[model samples]
Target: MFKVYATTPESMGPCGIAAHAARAEAMGFDGLHVPDAIHDGLLLAALALQATRRLRVGTSVLVAFPRSPMTVAVAAWDLQQLSGGRFELGLGTQIKQNIEQRYSARWDSPVPQLREYVQSLRAIFDSFQHGTPLRFEGEHYRFTRLQPFFNPGPIAHPDIPLLCGAVGPAMTRMVGRIADGMITHPTNTPPEYLRTVCLPRLRDGLERAGRDPAALRLILGPLVATGVDEQAVAQQWEQQRRLLGFLYSTPAYWPSLELFGWQARGAELQALTREGRWQDLPAVVTDEMLSAFVPRGSYAEIAEVLRARYAGLADSITFPMPQDTAQDTQAAAAIARLRA
Candidate 1:
């Protein structure tokens, strides 16, 4: 089945995460994805896991560069065991500035560094599971010590799945090679981007790893604008327009915009941002641009659109829940037919 996931609402506090999880489960959501923004996604995932019985919880995704591999391994390992193997450790190398300035951490070749990071994590998990020595030596990271005193020992669920959030081809290929799944960045995607840029690189990586392309989970978190009425669709479109303008300002994510010869548009947005003209940014994102990022339609039309766009390409999808009760009901019905 193609899994349907709902993102954890940022308005929820620590105690509210559990309630949100329970509600999402009742809504027929297959899983819950907690994004690492201002809040601690790991702690939130734990809370959600503790609350729900069958719903899978994942960090979509946690910033990996800020923490050590051993630290991530321990957290995911414990969570996996606690959740009876329902925990997925979704991680991402969140750009250079966020790592260097915000976290006060060093940043280097992200793809290779992340590859080493995942390998180190797997090695540590291996030691915990099989009582082996912890000795993982890599170019970017090294973990030669895991004393018995610090070890959590073996658990029933030792093979914790690793998911990576990626946009660039190199990082996407790395995900195909080393990760159980790839979480595509919401702002840097479309069906065309997936088929042309992401899939080719991923196929090459899967071939190198001697793995099947169909085996890897491709999770899409696209900006979707769907509603019961024109007014609601317009509201969602406005929100998506502002978001696209903000995201397109980042030059690093210009490839998707570049595909449609909109590199100049990205540059214009970047210029506006650098000039501190925040209000002017949204004005630059035209309706045509908004359509590229967010597909606008009625709630009843969404399922067919999603399948026509992402069928066979994506294994899962994450989107915002409609605020209108009747619209939400129709959307739920449509989403149920996504995998069928």
Candidate 2:
């Protein structure tokens, strides 16, 4: 069965998390996914978990640099226990500025750092399950004596499915090797790029690790904006286009867009930033740009587009909530069409 999920908008504040999760469950969505941004994804996940019974909750990604692996592992374990084992841990290495300036952490050798992070998480879980002493010495993390007092004890499934948020080849491959699934960025990657570039790298990683690629779950979060009014839909599309333009302009996000035949536009977007043309972003962003970056239409039309876009690859589809619509009614209508 294809699973549908929802995200609370970045501007919606944390109070919307429980409200959205409740609507998602009541509307028959399979899961609730929260993006890891300046906001707290785990806190949102906890709220969602408490609000719904059957809906699985997870972060689209929690950046690796902001918090230590041991700390994340403990929190994840506690969430799993509290949520009755319905929590999935999604992790990523965010760009340099967010890591260094915002989080006050060093950003170096992300691939290696991520590998060590995953290893440490697994090691901590293993120690809890088997009552064995845990010892791991990695470039990014080291743990020698894991006190029993800090341990949350074993979950029903001690091995929580780890999902990596990946866009490039190295991270894609790493996901197949170590993660149970992957969460892809919608604005940066097209479906064709995912099939031709990202998926192949993932398969290669699974092959190298002696794992079956077919067994892995692929989760996609397609940025979507739906409204009952056509004019409102157009305005929402423009807003999303400007937002994506701002993101693609960043050097850290350019690689993903470049992979999908948008290098020149990516460079232009970046140039706009260099010139401090922030106000002119909407002018540079065309209707074509908005359509390519996000699915936008009336609720029914958007649902159909999403169903088609995610037809085969996505085991779960997460749509970022429409900026112009009422969350509860829009969610109910979209879920009705998606499940139909």
Candidate 3:
């Protein structure tokens, strides 16, 4: 069965996260994927976990560079313990400009930095689990001390499944080499992009690491524009198109555009952003480009469309909760079919 996870919108209020998670569980979703956008992702995850008994909570992902590995490990450990081993830690390295400017965090070579981050987190978790010495020295990060006094010793769930977000080749390969699983960024979640670009690099990494092909999990969070009917789908399409226009403007996410010979369109979007033309961004996203990022249909058939599109491609996928609670059953039906 392909697991289906619930995702929240960027505009959702913090107080709504718990209610959303409860609804997702009631709707039969396997898990909830929270974002580190307007609200702290872990805090939101805590809310969700507290509100639901069985639904797993994970960060779609949490930004890694801005916080220390040990700090993050401690939080993740506690969340895992609290969730009864239901928490998955998914980390992502935001692009340089966002890291340096928006986050006021140091930005270096991200592939290696994130690799070291994941390794250091495991080393810390190991020490916390078994009374062993904590020593992980990497080019980007070094952790040689974990005094027993400071160490939050062992939880029942010692193995917190470490997931990484990846879209580029270097990052995807690194994730396959180190991550227990990977969360595909929305911009890079199309079926063709996964088959032609991501899977090959991932296999190369898995081969390099001498790991079993099936051991690593791949979760595709593709942008989907589906609703109860044609009118609803069209509304969702427009919303997703505007979102894609904003996302593809980032050069790091342009690999998908390049794959489809739409790099020029990507550049045009970027130029619009550079000129501070925020309102014009949506206009630049044509139907053709929108179709690449978002698969459109009614909820009645969207699951079949996705199943056929990603049949053997992904182990898990993300489905967002509808803004209106009235349409949840319609969305839930699709989620159930995907999970089946």
Candidate 4:
């Protein structure tokens, strides 16, 4: 069984995020994983950590390519200090178009680049904490400058955990080799895919690096349909269908589908996106596929379902906070069960 985290919804601004974090803490969630999509992840983390007393605040993934490692290190360091060691920084490399066009950041050689980014962050942390003289030279990034006046200097907690979002083998392997943890993409967390592809690849990297597999946190952020009753559960299942319809449209996420002989369905979803048939997309995901991916049960039983599904695989799992505040009590009860 794995501990549950509140997966903070995307597109929320500062106040909403703080409120959500406070609510999650009140509900007994061990942590909140905030997104870096529409807003600054670091800023959201600051608010989330400040608002909550005991809940861990982490960026589910803050895009790594757009921001300099030095900038991220400083922000993460400060958040760790302020949170009394409950801040985690999860990093990711966005696709080329978004990285280059949307963010206006140079994008090339992502796996290596991300590997270097993690290394660079660690080096910067070392310099900041112990004054070890920052010198991380890699193809994508190089940092050799750190004046004593500019350095933020040591904090009470210097061993900040660095997590990464990874789906592909290379990125997953890199995560095992370097990062403190790996957060699975929602589409890539099906048990068979993880057992066959992800865990093995991660172990390869861990073996190469001579790091213990137990040290790597494998968090499964799967889609689960939970509610007080069947009707409410159905609503969540439908929502997941629409979300998956949008997500699988990206070919980059097709490998998991390919493993399950659903690659053609992924292509079909992509075709619908290309044809701009957004409304029709959800219909493409059949009930069979939905059942295969999502766990659906009442809040009272969903924890057992998750345990049966993910035990011995994921070190932690994420369960979404209910969209309606009315459902908070049931959702909170479910989280408590998961934690226990």
Candidate closest to the true structure, highest lDDT: 4
Clashes of 4: 0
Location of the lowest summed lDDT over 10 successive residues in candidate 4: 1-10
Give me the overall lDDT of model 4: 0.90
Candidate 1 lDDT tens digits, 70-156: 888888988999899889889999889889999999899999999998899999999988879989888899889878989999998
lDDT of all predictions, in order shown?
A: 0.85, 0.77, 0.90, 0.90
Candidate 2's displacement at residue 222, Å, is 1.7
User: How big is the RMSD of model 4?
Assistant: 1.0
lDDT of 1 at 327: 54
Assess every candidate by TM-score: 0.95, 0.92, 0.98, 0.98
**Candidate 2's residue-wise lDDT over 133-169, tens digit each?**
8999987789898788966676686768888888667
Candidate 1 TM-score to native: 0.95
Q: Alpha-carbon error at 211 in model 3, in Å?
A: 0.5
- Candidate RMSDs in Å, in order, are 1.6, 2.1, 1.0, 1.0
* Candidate 1 positional error at 62, Å: 0.7
lDDT of 4 by residue, 1-340 (tens): 4667899878788979889999899988889999999888899999999998999988989999989999899999999999999999999997888999999999999999999999999999999989998898999999999999989999998999999999888999999999999999988888888899999999999999999988999888999998889999999999999998989889999998888899999999999989999999899999988887888998888998988888789778999898888989988888877877
